[model samples]
Target chain A: GAGVSQSPSNKVTEKGKDVELRCDPISGHTALYWYRQSLGQGLEFLIYFQGNSAPDKSGLPSDRFSAERTGGSVSTLTIQRTQQEDSAVYLCASSRDMSSGANVLTFGAGSRLTVL
Target chain B: AQSVTQPDIHITVSEGASLELRCNYSYGATPYLFWYVQSPGQGLQLLLKYFSGDTLVQGIKGFEAEFKRSQSSFNLRKPSVHWSDAAEYFCAAWRSNTGKLIFGQGTTLQVKP
Candidate 1:
């Protein structure tokens, strides 16, 4: 793909239901990131994947929020027992590498999740 | 910990008028600053970034930003505003070691024709 692609552009689920969001990053990009955008919180980093190494999960809000990157290209973010506060736009971004140089990221349209 | 701050929650400017947006960052070391724009229902697009060298950096769409190290500020500026420039602007700082971005609360730019 020419740019980062995300699935389920919009999802509305009942409370306590689990939801999954997918992301397909640009070809050959080794760095991928997941972010959440809410009404007043702005963009918050959720997770980061760099190659096969362990993902940086420091930003995951809770135990229910988790993510995985398969084949180093496609990524999935799963939220368990969704809460009304979990409603937000989930965004995916990819970068060429993690070098000291400018790390410009390409973002996807994002998936809007609404927990009812 | 690193954080970015955008003071103005909303800014309104008349068409063809000069515009400026203020941003500040808190970091212990040199920061990699960036400005991104988001149109309605669209993804974030990078406007410009400051990694090293010249304090004044030019970006796409005739936008420019200046990095003031002493004040820890990176302000975006444009010579003239257009109707199409109406969008949400975000200021961010990248932690090179961690490869994560800290974004500010974003400023909504309203251009009046």
Candidate 2:
């Protein structure tokens, strides 16, 4: 793909239901990240995957939030038993490589989640 | 931990006016700085970035940013503002070893025509 792609641009689900968001990073990008943006707020780091290394999940708000990247390609972010506060725009970004010591991220349009 | 701060939550300026948006960062070492713009319902677009170079860095759309190491600031500037420039602006920083970004609360710009 020419750029990072995210699926389900808009999602609405019950408060207790689980939802999944997907991200397809730019081809050849070795680093991927997930972020959450609440209304009128800054982006909050959720998770990061670098090659085959252990993912950095330091930013996941709770145990209910989990994400995985398969085969070093597409990634999925799953929020179990979503809460109203969980309603936000989930953004995915990727960088060409980490070797440069400069990470310039290209982002997707994001998946907007609404919990009712 | 690396963090970015954008002081102004919202700002309004007349068209053709000079514009400046302030961003500050907190990190143990000098960190990479960036500015991004986001239109409504759109993804973030990099406006400019500062790695290791001259203090002033230029970017697309006639935008530029200055990295002031003494103040731990990276302030974005434009000689003249355009109506199309009205959007949400974000300031972010990342450590050299990692790809994760710590974003500041965005500043909303409203261009009054």
lDDT of each: 0.93, 0.92
Name the docking class for model 2.
high
Interface DockQ per candidate: 0.87, 0.86
Fnat value of model 1: 0.89
Per-prediction share of native contacts kept: 0.89, 0.94
**Residue B12 error for model 2, in Å?**
0.6
Q: Determine which window of 10 residues in candidate 2 chain A has minimal summed lDDT.
A: A49-58
lDDT of 2 by residue, B41-102 (tens): 78999999999979999999999999999999999999999999999999999986655789
lDDT of 1 by residue, B22-60 (tens): 999999987899999999999999999999999999999
Local lDDT at B9 for model 2:
97
The TM-score of candidate 2 is 0.98
Model no. 2, DockQ: 0.86
TM-scores for every candidate against the unseen true structure:
0.97, 0.98
Model 1's TM-score against the true structure: 0.97
